[model samples]
Target: MLAELINPYYLQVASFILINIILGVSIYITLSTGQLSLANAGFMGIGAYTSALLTLNFDLPIIGGILAGTLLAGVFGILIGIPTLRLQGVYLAIVTLGFGEVIRVIFVNWESMTKGAVGLSGIPHMGRELLNTLKEFGFDPKILGLQNNQFVFLAIFLILLGVTISIITFFRRQNRSRVGRAFAAIKLDEKAAESMGINITYYKVLAFAQGALVAGFAGALFAHVLAYISPADFAYHRAVEILIFAVFGGSEVIWGPVFGALFLTVMPEVLRFISEYRYMIYGLIIIIMMAVRPQGLIDVNILNWLKLKTSKRRQKHGTSSQKSM
Candidate 1:
């Protein structure tokens, strides 16, 4: 009766929210360097297919597959970044977009490996695998009342979310370090950054590679969590959605993308009552947000103002208590 009262689908949605948060952070890392590359979806596809195949064929552990996928994507990022990172603005976007399409096409045509457009199924579930592994080590989940697969999955995702956030927090702090300043300088002005002894090419490529690595990690998790994948999963619009998460949330701070991902992922579900018009409303919200708060839903200025307001409120409350005394 207790289990029936709770919605299993909500847990699934929560898992997706966590996945999207990782995706949002991935693109923000690239955007931080001012490169408008759109190849994250491609990197994601590479990670998904690579990890899926490795696990399916070789019985590789989930962690092994994820690491393999991430490293492979990073290598591709470096290769693609070397030539394409030189371009700025829309030109880079166009190239990366093309790269994404090319990857989809490859996935579609590689029937022997990817099974063509039919997609791959029966990919190992991370939760199930972990559970089995634990059982092998004589550990029982029932001891903690986590015998349910859904709860196990949620637990794993929460751990991954926590770890990913910690890494992003570390990266955020790096913004004040020398490398962070170099990234900032390059974003501000490539020529000026180059003149300041900053290696524009190296830092730009580094940012791009890091973004790909992160996206690949997210993709690996996405594949296992859902246990199926297709070329369509990494389509052009998917890349656009990831970009919107960063833009709408305000990429100036790492938390901006995280907030953006959470809001956008949940908004549709919350508006399910108006399913037909939900998309229209969604479009309008984006248009309005772009028009009104071009800096995003969060930024340095907003954070500072929020801190000021909070401090002032605390001071006012203290003064009132003192007056009463």
Candidate 2:
């Protein structure tokens, strides 16, 4: 069993884990800020299609292609977020779902750029091309300008994942900042906060844009890692799966999505021949989990809830003691 996992195919699974981890965390962004975004699939599609087309047509490097994709996706996010994030609960969910569908239709119709339903073909391979990625590292061109693709791909993934983790951690800390307070205020009580002069729209939009950026980046990474991406890869179902894992993990925290993504991505592969029954078992597990722990299977929310309850109980006891005295 261990030997099979050590094989080359395992590399693909590892990459899959990385991709889902990004997706999960990206969804975590809006979720933490109290927004439920279903448009992650659209953002992912935007990044995948953008990066793939850029590399294939312009012969650009991975970094440049990814940057271009991220920029475009962010712009689209700003446009959608400006108007949509204000809606909360099922209303916001429906709006985001519509947004995802719109992107899907565009991908299907934009044959010149996306190749429509037939899907883009003959896209450049990530192998030797991936090796050329060292140019971004300021590595000595004289020695290892062209490392093996396998080695380079893994290195780049690690570097990118590290950078991503750092960014998320930084953002999590900012939750204590004024801006974070604004988001928390809005999330907790929009009407009260708005009455007090907080511009709920701006904070919601920021959360939306941040989530889109991460999803786009995830799409770009998956594209370059696999060297092939299609509309099928970013379908609405995929977006739902990302959101499900985010909630099932713990959107209240940052790394929950990462853990959720890793767990869910590997679960199916382990089922092997029972793959046909995989999602069934997976669904049952999620249902059972939610029944027991609706907050999340691995939620840290319990501590906060217990603290609140204990403090209230102590206050009540103190009041009774004072009255008796």
Candidate 3:
């Protein structure tokens, strides 16, 4: 696993997995609050555009660009959440879906700023400078036979790992906190949650804002890594893609989407042999899986099993250490 972390090819795939995990978690935030929001991709577009423009025009540092993007998108999330979160079920999904389309159209028609469908290019890669810094500090790349890109990949991987861990820890804490309990109540039953003194509106809006923050940060990182983006990139189709990441991954559990995104992101590549029928095969597989197990691949049972396995392993290791002593 350590050896593969520095492999450039695998690193690229890993980057996709990380980004998708972030996106999945973003939606999971809303779903946790019993809100069905499909506007994540729209918020992501806002972040990508904001960060890309800041870096391109104002000469802002990549981190500054990302921060600005995240803040701006959170504001947008609050704005959108105010009206849309009031709706429920398919209606809410439709309105949010429309919002995504509206954002995409604005990006397309606002040619003066977005360059329309021509797409932004020449965006800087976020970790390139870190690699240069490592070299300047007397680190010998030749010692490991690693190229500059590999170093860049390692930097990105570590940064993303930190981000993922921090976010996951924060979310897990939320799951145990008062807010998380309120979210659970609302999700299980809104009227009942309201009766119990939970402010449904406030919590729903907070969920939207939280989700947007994550999506925006992911988008900023995405723009920097890919070095290009366009209006079409944030279309309704993109919104649906992100939704698939959440739903197919088992939105019930925090880690489910990560698993789903990782598998789905790599599955197509693995099925590339039958290029023409790859998507057909993929769709068929999803249909079969949904039919057999609609709750998704990850659920309470699997999570518990994993936890139990880890605990046993730890106990065994502790016993060995004590005996050796």
Q: Among these predicted structures, which one has the highest lDDT? A: 1
TM-score for each of the candidates = 0.92, 0.81, 0.92
Where in model 1 is the C-alpha error above 4 Å? 1-7, 313-325
Cα lDDT, model 3, residue 206:
92
What TM-score quantifies how close candidate 2 is to the native fold? 0.81
Q: Which stretches of candidate 3 lie over 4 Å from their true place?
A: 1-5, 133-140, 309-325
lDDT of 3 by residue, 1-325 (tens): 4444477877787887888888889998998887888999999999999999999999898899999999999999999999988799989999998988898899999999999999999887877866666779998666676677777887788788889878888998898899999999999999999999999999999999999999888888889888999988888887888888877878888888788888888888789999999999999978887887788888889889997787789788885333321
Pairwise lDDT winner, candidates 1 and 2:
1
* Candidate 2 segments exceeding 4 Å error: 1-7, 125-127, 132-153, 273-275, 302-325
List the lowest-lDDT window of 10 residues for candidate 3.
Answer: 316-325
lDDT of 1 by residue, 48-106 (tens): 99999999999999999999998998899999999998789999999999999999999
| Candidates, ranked, lDDT | 1, 3, 2
Give the C-alpha miss distance for residue 60 in model 2, angstroms: 1.7
Flag clash pairs in model 3: none
lDDT of 2: 0.77
